[model samples]
Target: MATKHEILSEIDTNFPEYLTFLQTFIRAASPSPPGDTTEAASIVFDFLSSHGISAETIAPQPHMPNIVTDFDGGDRSGPRVVLNGHIDTYPVGNPDEWKHGGPYSGYNDGLQIHGRGGVDMKAGTAASTIAYILLKKRAQKLKGSVALTVASDEETGGKWGTRYLLEQGGKASPWRGDCVINGEPGGLQSIRFGEKGTLRLTFTIRTKGANGAYTQLSRGANIIAAQLIQRLLEIESMTPHLSEELRKHFDSSEVRLVANEIMGPGTAEILLAPTINIGTIRGGFKVNVIPEECVFEADVRLPIGLLAEEVMDHVYSILKDFPEASVSKQEAPSNPANYCSIDHPFAKHIADTTEHITGRRPVQLAGLGGTDCKFYRYLGIPAYVIGPSPRSMGASGEAVDIAEFKALIKIHTLAIWDYLGSNA
Candidate 1:
């Protein structure tokens, strides 16, 4: 095992250039705008090329592109590993919430990188890129390969990114690997095992016409809207038996109480069931005449192994209580949860490497949200999330701990070395 001093030295040697590259990336406003990723993807690919890595940009569509590069581990016939991350981020919301300049300003706050994608992900992407570069430089003759796949449109559904790559045969790409590691915001301490599935449904409710031409007091859609809101709120409040993993993380009574209070009675139970969110509601066409239509769009996050049909059944059950309600339309694009046992050989290696580098053992973590890891897992590849934050502080405050960053580079480097027996 490399000593902490050795790891620190390595990071110190590479840190300057790495920070420069990362800052440049942070400056590029790569928000996912439906099928558009030209500038951001190009910048990432160009950076990789400048670092002496043989990189390729595969633009599936004009707006979204995929940057791929790899190092052939000696013979090029051994196990292949893919390091993946998205190059896009959600739009900078409420710039006033920003402490520095604009969200894409890439302001170096003396201690941490500050920007929109700076924490939520751009940090992970940069860490992964730098680690890969170091790995290629240090472990030159392994028996396998290492691929860096930085894709676009992840802020949205990844339809033009991962999905397009897979559809156009990502597995067929150069340096395509057997398993993948998605560099999501995992706080650099825990290896995220899996994520919950998602279901989006829209409910439209209509009321009977009023018998008035100019003004009708009681014949408007408001009545039906009121009932629908009440019932929908009820459905949103349904709680299921949360997975053991979720309970383990949120164990305090105060947290549980807050969950219940906001989610309503049985919210915990329904957490294990399917989670629901009424995101949008709009009704009432005219003030004088009662409008006859009311609609609501809901977002539901489901735990692993739960079927979308089962979720819809629960929604129907809630609506059935109100006879006048109609469901209208629904769609659930689900990516089943994927987990790797902490005791698995690779996982053990990663954990051991992390501990060796950080003097801290890794805790197993479950994904509260979803990521493109779903796509890789769906394709029969075991994937996990890991990154550079020291705690659960992505999109919030707290900078990426420099120590954690150094430790991750060492851990990932050794893990890859162990996989390829490169040290030999």
Candidate 2:
């Protein structure tokens, strides 16, 4: 069954050494908020130990580590396949707002391959290290065992790579897996069957006292922090909104025209809305009398089956008439949704292997920000998301598509032999 044009002509004769090992692994700049990545995880552990595979880096602390590699087939106790990524990024924000040249410049104009983890992920770690070297050179008697992790602080929320590899059982060692794949750009024609459940709360409001006294009295805690920031903009325009799979995912119409072009049209028709941010505001430390107080911070976000204690009980029932207003939960709330059900057979084998290699039909949106599939749905492990991003791939002259990097190593070497049934 190896005829996707003979696996894209053997990944087009190993596409110029996989684009020169992804431009020397995206110029080894490793940007994870200075969480550095040990020279890009030592160039993927010296290119998977020069191909024989059995590499390791796994640093829980000594500054940016998490490399871990292993390649073995034929009964390592069958069914195991992990291929995560994230050699850190998300900081090259403004190398002069680069349209072309900046941030560890790994440029290559012969049909794209630019910079900044080129397409948000060093092209899914160079397509999972060329699909595990073409699935150990065409499934050499496949049975199990295959890990190629490279993670590290997944753009800030994996407190140092997959939560330090699940706090160092490293997923119960031997690179445990019964199906795990996270080459996260997710635009290589879709396979992300879930996402959208992040809770960030920060509500700080203070006002009380006197600096110079009586310039016209009436202070009452800076007028109850301006009527509790206008009742948190009416509890951020009504909190108890989203219902049933987050209100049929914002009641489509292209998701209400992309949420009325990013929260406009009267706050996006307030349709099942649940995101509010007054970001930050400081109190009056001066500027004369009645300068009692005025501090505010709001950044609430919730959607997927909304329940961060019912959004802090609808934000204390919309500040239950401000009894000297006060509430603080900067980030304790978390829901981690994306329920995985498109008749889950690992979501129809990643939506029929991304429409059998992209004839287009993969946009089943909802990740709306937040990955590491929410810590593998807090470890039940039915994660989802595919890779090889490409539609004008992350803009600003961004790139990474030397022919979709050989069609993402021939669709992950036939999606790891159709996700491990392997009759090979």
Candidate 3:
């Protein structure tokens, strides 16, 4: 308790500078699709270097780069904990629609910090970065080590960032740890032990061209695309066979409130069942021309206990009727819904430490969307996400509450301290 108090005191005293760091971080826009994060990566690298923490940058994708740094505990035999975060943010659409001096503003209106990357998680990553720095500063004689991976390409699926480092060095990989901790935006009250998986696909239809009045000469591609969308919605009816115990846990008021509150209303419905979104559709160029081709993009989310292959099989079944229609997944690898038990030591450390800090226990629930955590969970490593509330992630006018962001830094630092310090 004494050590914890000392840590908290140091955090509070140093928080103002941390806020400045966060604002500077937010000001550096690293939106994906364009997927370039060179500037943000350089900023992270320079900051770490300024602190005397050496880092390595890997950029096989050129525009997208990653930053890695590691430090050992007092003893090498203690557990290795990986802290993961991303530099890229969702693309800011329509700069005019944003508030608080626009998306890149990094403006703090006293209560919240406004900007593009703060909610979806440049702020959370900041928490991890600072926690790593604070932990390193302690220079305490503890067991094991903590490694930080501030990577790029997470918003577009991490092909050149975290996944790259994880795949590089075999079993004793540079990024592999006993477990991973990710500061994704899921609100403080909700400690996410699992995440929903995604299958991003583009459905296409093709047919011989014809004049608008000459539909009899060829089938309209737009018609096939519409019918295909209708069939795909059937997949939404699918449900995961979760354990009764897990369902009972979710039934608890603590879990129910946190799940819906963190992810939004009706979260349980979507968290337990597969959900579908038909994002966009494009067909004929002009009214005078019969549509020869149509393309529609979709994002299908699977609940925990469901697999991507299961959904793909269902998709293939639905496409049997239309030979002209075909579907293809996005180039990045798709993952299944994954998790570790709520009782896992790392998860409990976060939940318990948060309760100790705030006097309110956090509830375990699954987040609605995917995160870099899934990549580690796929390899049998447990990954947990507990960060700030996602007030307007991937949308205009994104913000992070000042109080909540502060709480995140404290909780993460102490939980990490609790995990490794105990080993000493």
Candidate 4:
């Protein structure tokens, strides 16, 4: 049996190969919206095949392929572990806005890898791929299987990606695993066990149109829009009920201190309350005209233990004051807040492994944003996230420190081995 140090020493010796893999992955542009992950999936398939690991491409939609592969353990009765990461990245808005490199440049300064998806996820995906290969080499000595799932359609919501793979109600879905470890750039200092839910609402206001000179005579739709914005902002103050176990974890001095370090000051409060963001607004055709109709969108995120229905009730209660404004749930994707206990065996093993590697114990917290892990949680399988803290996720100058990237890979490799090898 290879000790943890032996496994890490091997990873360190082959760090260059891992770095090259990540650079190649970053160079392949798999942006969501027109999310065509075939190019990236092909890269993954080729890499796995070259290393004697059998993999297959499953594309429910054209050009959106999901790469699935697995290594069997010695004991077939042991649990199966899933290693997951998204291939598609947020679309780079404007290439010219990038001061460092173009979105797909995959520029490496021997210190950091710069590109749109470098940190947002391609790096994590690359790490998981390498980790899977490492685990495969030791499969004969292990007691469970390790399944690798590189998914598409995460940035724009995973309707055609993870959701289809795991919950399409199909008979022979290949995504069935006992637990999932998603490498989604949550930072090495934290192991995210939960994520906030999304409820996007679009508010529309319509009123009688009138000329610009008609003051106090016309009901301006813009005025009603402004009032709705005020009410939406108030949702931030609404408190959420946290489970006693979660609350106890949050109140711990260690967790609070680590949360502040990883997520910035006041992050604790943000995680405990519902958050509202007015994403978009469109109204008048001209500056002078009293607009007859105005529309705006608000993105509401519910904390763990908070139901979307409860948040909607609060929204409706606030809307009562603005009778002229009508709001409707948009076609935007949404799900209730999901979580797994911090005390779960898988979570604890990850935390212990992380501490062993980094000497800094990771804090367990509810993720502020969403990830493909939510789908696994929906299936009652516990999912956890631990990866590099992306310096630039969706904006220009996106990159991940190469040092941290390697460290992240080490963490994933060690943790996966620790978890799957426990039953050996």
Each prediction's number of clashing residue pairs: 15, 1, 1, 0
Greater-TM-score candidate between 1 and 4: 4
Instruction: State the lDDT of candidate 2 residue by residue for 1-424, as single tens digits.
Output: 6554566677787688878888788888877677787887788778777777776777777777888766667655677777777787766666777655676677788887787777677777777777876677655567777777777877767776766675566567655466566667656545655555656554454545565556454464556676777766654454453447645655756555543443245433543446666756666655665545566666655545555676677778877777666786645334445545444454566666667777754544444556675665566566666776534344555667777766666666667656666654
Task: Name the candidate that leads on TM-score.
Answer: 4
Task: Give lDDT for model 2.
Answer: 0.65
The weakest ten consecutive residues by lDDT in model 3 span: 135-144
Candidate 2 regions exceeding 4 Å error are 17-101, 107-114, 117-192, 198-209, 212-281, 285-295, 299-305, 312-314, 321-337, 342-348, 351-384, 388-409, 412-424
- Per-prediction TM-score: 0.82, 0.35, 0.94, 0.96
Question: lDDT score, residue 294, model 3?
Answer: 96
TM-score of 1: 0.82
Please state every model's RMSD to the true fold in angstroms.
Answer: 4.8, 18.2, 1.9, 1.7
Highest lDDT: give the candidate number: 3
What's the residue-level lDDT of 213 in candidate 3? 91
Tens-digit lDDT track of model 1 for 180-279: 6666766655676666677777677666656446344454565766666666555444444555855665455544453354334654444344566777
lDDT of 3 by residue, 169-224 (tens): 86879688998888899888878889888888998999998898997887699988
What TM-score would you give candidate 2 relative to the actual structure?
0.35
lDDT of 4 by residue, 144-257 (tens): 788998989998888878887887556355576888887787788899999899988889998878888885877689988887788778788877787687788877888777
Worst 10 residues of 4 by lDDT: 167-176
Q: Model 4 residue 109 lDDT?
A: 86
Q: Which candidate do you rate higher for lDDT, 1 or 2?
A: 1
